[model samples]
Structures are given as C-alpha cells and as structure tokens.
Target: MSDATLMLSGIEKSYNRGTPGEVSVLRGVDLSVQRGEVVALVAPSGAGKSTLLHIAGLLDVADTGRVEIAGQDLTDLSDTRRTATRRADVGFIYQFHHLLPEFSALENIVLPQLAHGVPRAQAQTRAQDLLDRVGIAARADHRPAALSGGEQQRVAFCRALANEPKLLLADEPTGNLDPETSDQVFAALMDLVRGTGLSALIATHNMELAARMDRQIRLEAGQLIPLGGAQRPA
Candidate 1:
C-alpha cells in the first residue's frame, strides 16, 4: 500500500463496447492525489471529467486498471466491499445539493454519519459544528426549501464530510450558482477542507477556482496532463 489518498493508473472506460457507436471516456488515465493535497481537474464540458471522478470515487468502475484510495486498491474489490470502502474513505459532492426535501439541514448532515455507525448525539454535535464552520449554524434547523442556493450547497458539503472520509471528490460543486454565490460557497468549501486536512480532487470548468488549488491537472484526449508549468495566482 502507498500513502496516496487517491490513485488511478492505466484506467480505461468505454460505453457500448464492441459496437459501432462505442465511445471511450478514459484511456490509460493515471493520476495520484496525496494526503491533504488539493488538486484541480480542469476540462471542457464534454470531456471525461465526470467519468474520471466517478471512477475515482468508486461510484463507477473502470474497464481496466487500478483505483486506490488511502493506499487500498479497490479495482478488484467485490461491489459490497467497494461500497464499504467508499463509505469509509471517500466523500463526494456534486453540482446539485441533493439534500432530502423533508429533512432539516442538520438532519441531512447527520444521517450519513448515523449510517456509518456514528452515535446519534455525536453525529448531531458534528453536524452543528460543520454548519457553524460554514457560518450557517442559524440555518441548521431549516429544511432545504427554506435555504438559499449557497446555504443548501453548504449543507451538502457538511453532509459529505459527516462520515469523516479521507478523500473528497467534487464535480462542479458550484456550477449551479451565480458568480457571487459560487465564490462564497467555494470559499466555504475550501476553508472546511483545509481545516480537516483532507485530500481533494475537484473537477471544474472555472479556471479561477482551479488556479487556487495546490495543483492542477487537465484531461485531454483521454489522458492526464500535469499543469505544473501553468501560471497560477501568487
């Protein structure tokens, strides 16, 4: 086992295999994200960003190659075992909040922890603390319908972190927000992630946000390209 928080090597994925309409999303893609390191994955809308993210998060599998998180190789795990590993080691966020319509903000955050075997009292405490960190403790009792876009995304962030996963994978988390709200929400997310020392691989079309990450990589023609020479803000 290695120390990387997330690693993918020689990954390949295609749809409608052995057919005339087959589409290849990932081809021999390889990347590694270290513990406490944040990496930005930049690509166009039709690129394979989401495909790569799903594979990394274990929400989906690659046709071939390795998927490892916290030094554990998951490519060969049974579906049940892979799901267990995902719940234990990976946290995911998406463009939509996806909060339960009937649950209060705090409850939405607490549920995942509870499922992961956290005590109810402890989960509630952690949920409140997470809301406070995002400056939304006052909104913790409100349901998603009552909160604004930014607030709902913040709650989603809290829910994703509730299980205390080692790695966080986000796909355009702020893509649904207006520019101003997106900036605020992204800042809140960064602060929370840094405070917890969690590794992250975030996919985004927003170059400004990508530049803020510790490292940046791009997907082109089904391959990962390091952008070490790219200029980023000082």
Candidate 2:
C-alpha cells in the first residue's frame, strides 16, 4: 500500500459515448494526493475538473480507470461499499453553500455524522467544535438565511469536515463570494484543513489561491499537467 491518500490512474470519461456529439472530457487522467498534503487543481471551465473530483470522491464513476483512497483500491467496490467508503473517507465542498435552509448552522454539520451512526450527543459536540474552529461558533444556532455569505460558507466548510474524512474534494469553494470575503473564507478553510492535517484536492480558477496550496496541477487537453516546481505523481 502506498502512502497516498487519494490515487487515480488511467481515468477516462466521455459524455455521449459512441455518438457523433461524444465529447471526451478526461483522457487518462492520473493524480496522487499524498497524506496531509493539499494540492490545488487549476483549470478553467469545461476542463472536467468537477468530473475528476466527482470520480475521485466516489460520487461518480469513471468510464475506465482505478480510484484508490488511503491505499485501498475502491474502483470495484459495490455501490453500498462505495457509499460507505465515501462517507467514511471523503469530504466534499462546492462553489455554493448547500446548507439545508431549515437546519441551523450547527445542525447542518451534525447531520452527516448522525447519518454515519455517530451518537447524537457526540455528533453535536463534534459539530460545535468544527464550527468553533471555522470561527462560526457564534452563529451555530442561526439558519443559513440568517447568516452572511461568508458565515454561511463557513458553516458549509464545518459540515464538510464533520466526519473527519481523510481526503477533501473542493470545487471552487470560495468562488461565489466577493473578493475580500473570498480571501477571508479561503483562509479559514485552509486553516481548518491544515489544522486537521487532512489531504485535499481543491479545484480553483484563482491562481492566487492555487499558489497557496502545497502544489498545483492544471487540466489541459484532457490530461493533468504539473505546474511550477510540482512534480508529477509517479
């Protein structure tokens, strides 16, 4: 078993396969995210970054390839096992804060843990700790509608980390915010991730944010290309 937290090999995905309009999005995409390392995925729209994330997070299957998490080969897991693995090992965030409207900020974070079979009392404690870590503890009882954009997104971040997953997959996490708020929220997110010592593969169009990650990679021509001094994963 390798030390990588997430590994993808020979990944290939295409929409409308076998049809004239068939569009290949990912072509032999390979990536490896080491334990506790944060890697930025830099790509423009339509570059298939989201598709890659979905595959890596087990939310979607690749047309062909292998997906591994924590050195375990998950590519062939049954749907039930995949779901179990995903819930246990992967955390995901997106451009928008998808908190449930009726749930308070703390409740939003507690819900996933409860679903994972954590006792309600223990789940609430963990959720409150997460919210506190993200600097949103004061807003725990507020619903999404009551919080500011930054506060709402912070709640979303806490919710993502609720399960203490080994790997985090974030797609444009701060993209929906204004410039200043984006910077602040991104900082909060980085702090949370680093403090937890979790590995993350975050997709972003902002070069500045990408530079803050441990390494950067870009998707081009349907393949991942290492950027700057980052070495390609063997």
Candidate 3:
C-alpha cells in the first residue's frame, strides 16, 4: 500500500454488471492524493465523476481493484469495518449544502463529531472553531434557511471537516452558487483544507475552479486522465 492519504489502483465499477443494460463507470482507474494535496476532478455531465468520488470516499464499493485511505487498503473490509473506517477517515461535501433544515449551523457540524465519539463539549468547541474558520461563526445559531447561499455552503464545509477526516471528497461544492459566491465559498474550503493539511479530491465541471487546485485530472471514457495535452483512453 502507498503512503497517500487516498489512493486507488486499477479501480473499476459497473452498474447491473450481468444485465444487458450494464454500464461501466470507472475502469481501471489509478490515482492518489498525498497529504496537503488538493486535486481537481473534472468531467462533463454523465462522465461518472461522482461515482468515482463515491468509491474513493467509501460510500460505494468498486467491482475490482483497491482503495487505500491513509495507507490502509479497504477493498477487503467487511461492511461493518468499512462503515467505521468511512466515519473515521473520510469527509464528503456535495453540490447541495444538505444541511439539516431544522438544526442550527453549529448543531449540524457538531452532530458528526458527536457521532464519531467526541464528547459533547469537545464537539461543540470543534464545531465553533470550524465555523469561525469559514467566517460563519457569527451565524452559528442560524438555521440553513436563514443563511445566504455562500454562508450555507460554508457551513457545509465545516460539517464535512468536523470529524477531521484525512481525505475530503467534494462534488461541485460551489456549483450551486453564483460566480461571486462560488469564489468565496471555494476560498473558504481551500483555507480549511490548507490549514488542516488534508488531502482533497474535488469533482467539478468549472475549469476556472479546477485550475486553482494543485493538479487537475479529467474523467473521460470511464477513466481518469490528466487534463490538457495528450490523454488516455477511457
């Protein structure tokens, strides 16, 4: 196994594998993100970028190949062990904030840490610190509906990082906002990732945003290929 914070070797995934309508998504994909590295995953609609992210984040299983997080290969773990590993080693953000409408921003962030066995007081402290990191601490008591779009997404970033996962998988985290708001929210995310020295694989269609990362990889024909210049077959 490699020493990457997240790594995938020969990863493959298919839907309805034995059926006539079977579709392959990721095919023999290989990638890795080291500590403090931020990589952009670029793909057009229906390119299976999210599917790859799900497998990397441990939210879905691959049909073959290996997935390693923080140097531990997870392809052979039982469901119970996978769940525990996911809870402890991965953080995910989506295009939507997906914040609990009924809970305050602080509560949304605190809940994940609490579920991960952090004491309530410590969880609350961590949540508050995260809020402050994203410049949303002043709005910590607000519900999702009460915050602006950028603020809401900032809160979502905090929630994703609450458990201090070594790898963060974000799917178009700023895609829902206007360009101005997207920039702000993306900056906040970058700050948090850099501050914590976490590795991130962020899937985005926005080229401008992708260029801001440490490196860029494009998903084409069911495989990850480097962006720009000569490319690999799917």
Candidate 4:
C-alpha cells in the first residue's frame, strides 16, 4: 500500500534489442502520480511517448525497471493478474475513441464493467450516471455512426471512467477534433475527472492543452527535459 496512485522507476524500452535495427524509446524514465493531479507528458514524434504510455498502462512490457499501479508492483505479477490489474485500476482514453460500432453509446460505456463481472443492471445504472455527468445523457443511445465526433469522444471518456480507476491515461485524446470541439471534450473530461481526484498522465503535442496541466515535462533524446527551464546544449 503506497501513497502513489501510479509510479514508474527507471523504465526502459528498446525494440530489436539485439539487432542492428534496435531502437530504444525510454532510457531510465521515472514518473509518479498521486491522487488527483493532472500531469502533461509532452514529447515529439519518435521520442517514444506512445511507447512510454503503453508501458505505464501495462499494455506493453518495459525492457527494464518497474511499473507500479495503485501501489502494486506489476513486474512480478502473472499475465492474468496483470490483465486484471489493468482492467480494474487503469482507465485509458485513446485519440481515436475506440467504441464498438454496433453498440449504442450506453452499451459501449457499460460493456467494460460487465466484462469485469458487474451485474448488467448495476452496470447500466452506473453507465447512465456517467453519461449524465459527462453531459451526454441525451446522446447515450447514439451509436458511433450516429454521433458527432465530439459526442463519440464523450462516450469514450465515459467508458474509460466506468470502473472508477485510480489512474487515467490518455494519449492525444483531442488530436482528432477541431480546436473548438477539442476544447469542449477536454473541458468535459476535466470536469468529470477533477472531482474524483483521479491521477492522470496525458500525452499531447498541443502546447495549449499542455498549458492546462499542473506540470509540463518534455522528452528529448530519450530523457525528460523540464519545460520553460534553460535550454540544454545540443
């Protein structure tokens, strides 16, 4: 039982580890998130932002170091246990809003909970509540094909939060939206997650969005550089 909601220490990831094409993404990266803070992760393309995020979410394994979520060390867990930990403790929002095409927004939001063994009736109630809170109750019946891009993203946000996870990991969540729409979606997300004090680490190329976070850290040459600090030598 640690105080950190999410923690990563000396994380490293390398592709083609022993071959000529080997590429290392993370080099001893360390990050920590507590209770209800929003930390912005900023990095350019090929700086391994997505790779680092996947490793943090337990969606991918790091080459070295440790990842702990809600104080439980994942390195020693079995695959099944890891999967369960991810399902219960981590909530993920991707740029594309990966909702099921056939399911209505309500159904999409409730499905994850059902998979985790929550009864259908209880999950439905929770889904409805989330939709309302996110200002999408009116759009709950709209399928992906029927909803606007913003509405679809709203539903995706609701789905991510259905399980009340401690850590919320978002990757370029607003990248696909128009500036105005992106603002709306992000505002809704802040409102919904802020009250709960969910620890969040979001990666985005947009400085405007990054400015809204508590701390902004940039990645360069396999390392994190503090934003607004003196420029490091090339």
Candidate 5:
C-alpha cells in the first residue's frame, strides 16, 4: 500500500448476502492515508462513506482484507486488542456533538485521558490547553445543556484531540451547524490540529471543503476512487 498512517487493502464487506436483502458496503477498496496529511471523502448518501470511515478507524472490522495503523496490521487482532489499538491511535469526530451532557467541557475532555490512566494533573492541564486552543476555555465550566451547537462541537473537537492521536476520523463534523457557525467551528478544529503532524480522513459533502484538503476521494457503489476518476490527472 502507499506510505500511509492508515491503510485498508482489498477490503470487502456485506450484510445478509445470501438473500434478496443482501447489501454490500465496500468492495475490494484499497486506500492509504499518509501521516500529517488531511484527505476529504465526498460521496452521496448510501455510497458508504460512513461505512468506510468505520472500517478504517477499527470501530468495525472488515469482512476481508487488511487494515493497518502506523504499519501494524489489525485484521489479525482480536476485538479487545483492536479496541486498545484504536484508543491509543485514532480519534473520532461526528456530526453531532457527543459530549456528555452531565459533564462540563473541561471534564468531558479530561475523562478519556483518565480512562487511559493518565495522571489527573496532566490530563487537566492538557484538557485546559486544548479547550483554550479551541476557543472554549471560557466555556470550560459549562455543561452541554448550557452550550450552543457550535460551542458544543468545539468542545467535542477538544475531546477528540486530548489524546494526541496519530490519525483522526471525522464524519460530517460541521453538518449540524449554520454556515457561519460551521465555519467558526471548522476553523477552530483545523487550528487545533495545525502543526501537530496528525493525519486525518474526513467525510464531507461540501465540495469547497473537499477541494481545500490535500486530496479528495469519492465512494461509489462500494468502491473508493480518486475524485473525478482517471480524467483528473496522471
């Protein structure tokens, strides 16, 4: 595969394949997302963008082929081992803010670090710094219930970043906000990740955003291909 922070080779996935209800989500898809690179995935609904993100993040296993994270093949690992690998290496961002409603912004970001056994003092410091960078330090004490949609998403970005992951997976991160708020949140998210040497694969329907990233790929009929296919360039 290409020199990448993440790789999925010859992957095939389907469900209920023996009957008329059968559906194939990905077919022999091969992809390589290199380190420190940001790639956008743009596709129509039902094209399996989310499915491909899930498989790449190790949240769900592929039915065939190999998945590699920083050169370690995970297709052979058990569920428990896979979970451990993901916790340490990958970060996820979703369209909706998945922050814990009961926890304050700072607490929400720190909780994952605590789960991984990081020192409470260090976790707090890092979480605070992340919040500040995301422009949410002022809202650090507020719970999700008290925050606006954009504010909450900003907090989620901090939470996703607290671990300093090798690769990031985002699914329509700005999908729920208005144009202005979405731009603000997206700016903060990119700024927080700037100079971090992190790799990212983001699924988006926004053509402008797709064009801004290092590369763009499309999902169609369960296959992954370059944007505009072979007509674009050599």
Candidate 6:
C-alpha cells in the first residue's frame, strides 16, 4: 500500500458529456497528499478546484481514475461504504460557515459526531475541546445568529474536525471573512490541522494565504501544476 494519505490518479470529469455545452472540468489529474502535509490548491473562480476537491473527498466521483485514502482504494466503493469512509476519514470546510442557525455552536459541532455514533457526552466533550483549540470556547453556547462571522466560521471548523478525520479538504475557507479575521481564523485552522497531524488540501484565491501552506499547486485548464513560488495568479 502507498504511504500517501490521499491519492488521485488519472482523474477525469466533465459535464454535459457529448453535448455542445459540454465542459471538461478535469483531465487526467493526478495528485498525492502525504500524511501531515498541507497542500495549497490555488485557482481562480472558474477553475475546477471545487470539482477536484469533491472527487478527492468522495463527495463526487471521478469519471475515470483511482482515489485512495490512507492506502485504501475507494474509487469503486458502494455508496453506503463511501459515505461511511467519508464520515470516518474526511472533513470539509467551505467558503461559508454553514452552521445550523437554530443550534448552539457546541451543538452544531456535536451533531455529526452523534450521527457517526459517538455517545452524546463524549461528543460534547470533543466539541468543547475543538472550540477551545480554536479559541472560541467562550462562545460555545451561542447560536450562529448571535455570533460574529469569524466566530461562526470557527464553529464550522470545529464541526469539520469533530470526527478527527484523516484528511481535510477546504475550499476557500476564509473567503467570506475580512482580512484580519481571515488571518486569525486561518492561523487557528493551521494550528488545529498541524496539531492533529492530518493531511490537508486547501483551495484558496489569496496568494499570501496559499504561500503559508507546505506546498502550492495551481489548477489551470483542468490540470494541476506545482508552484515553486506563490506569485502565480489564482
């Protein structure tokens, strides 16, 4: 088995296949994310970074290729098994926090764990610990509507890591925040990721933010190209 935490080989995906409106989003893309490595995926709005992330996270399947997570080839797994693997081994963060408005920050973080069969008390403990790590433990009881944008996003981060997944996939996680808040939240995220030793593939339009990760790869014309310097246009 490969030592990589996440691997994608010959990945291909297209929409409206065989039609004039068809758009190819990815083409024979290959990547490997090793354990504890943080990779920055740099791309503009129209680039296929989201599609690649979805495939890598098992939220969507590639038209052709192999996807391996922690040495397990999950490309052909059944939907149920895929769901299980996703729940057990992958965590995702998006541009928006997407926290449950009706639930408290702590509850929002605890729900996924409950769904995964973690006991309520244990899940709550883990949720609080995550909130503490992100420096938001004081806001644990507040609902999303009552929190600031940065606070809400921090809760979302806790929710994502509630399961302690082996791999993290984030798509413009700080895009909605202002620069100062983005930087603070991003630092918390990096700390959490590094502290737990999880592999990560984070997509970002900000070159400064991308440069902070361990390595950077730009998605252009449906293919990934390694970037030695972070000055490339996203």
Each candidate's TM vs. the true structure? 0.96, 0.96, 0.95, 0.94, 0.94, 0.96
Give each model's whole-structure lDDT.
Answer: 0.92, 0.93, 0.91, 0.87, 0.87, 0.93
Q: Write the per-residue lDDT of candidate 5 for residues 41-140, one digit (tens) a residue.
A: 9889888889899999998878899999999888989889989888899999999988999899999999999988899999999999998888778899
The list of candidate 3 runs beyond 4 A from truth reads 228-234
Clashes of each: 0, 0, 0, 1, 0, 0
Regions of model 5 farther than 4 Å from truth: 228-234
Per-residue lDDT tens digits for candidate 1, residues 84-202, read: 98998989999999999999999999999989999999999999999999999999989999999999999999999999999999999999999999999999999999989999999
Per-residue C-alpha lDDT of model 6 across residues 1-234, encoded as one tens digit per residue: 577999999999999999999999999999999898889999998889999999999999898999999999999999999999999999999999999899999999999999999999999999999999999999999999999999998899889999999999999999999999999999999999988889999999989888988889999999999995433222
Residue-level lDDT tens digits of model 3 in 47-105: 99999999898889999999999888899999999999999988999999999999999
TM-score of 5: 0.94
How much is the lDDT of residue 88 in candidate 3?
A: 92
CA lDDT for candidate 3: 0.91
- lDDT measured at residue 118 in model 2 versus the true structure, 0 to 100: 97
Colliding residue pairs in candidate 1 = none
lDDT against true structure, model 1: 0.92
What range of 10 consecutive residues in model 4 has the weakest lDDT sum?
Answer: 225-234
Among all windows of 10 consecutive residues in model 6, the one with the lowest summed lDDT is 225-234
Number of backbone clashes in candidate 5 = 0
lDDT preference between candidates 1 and 6, better one: 6
Give the clash total for candidate 4.
Answer: 1
Q: What is the lDDT of residue 74 in candidate 3?
A: 94
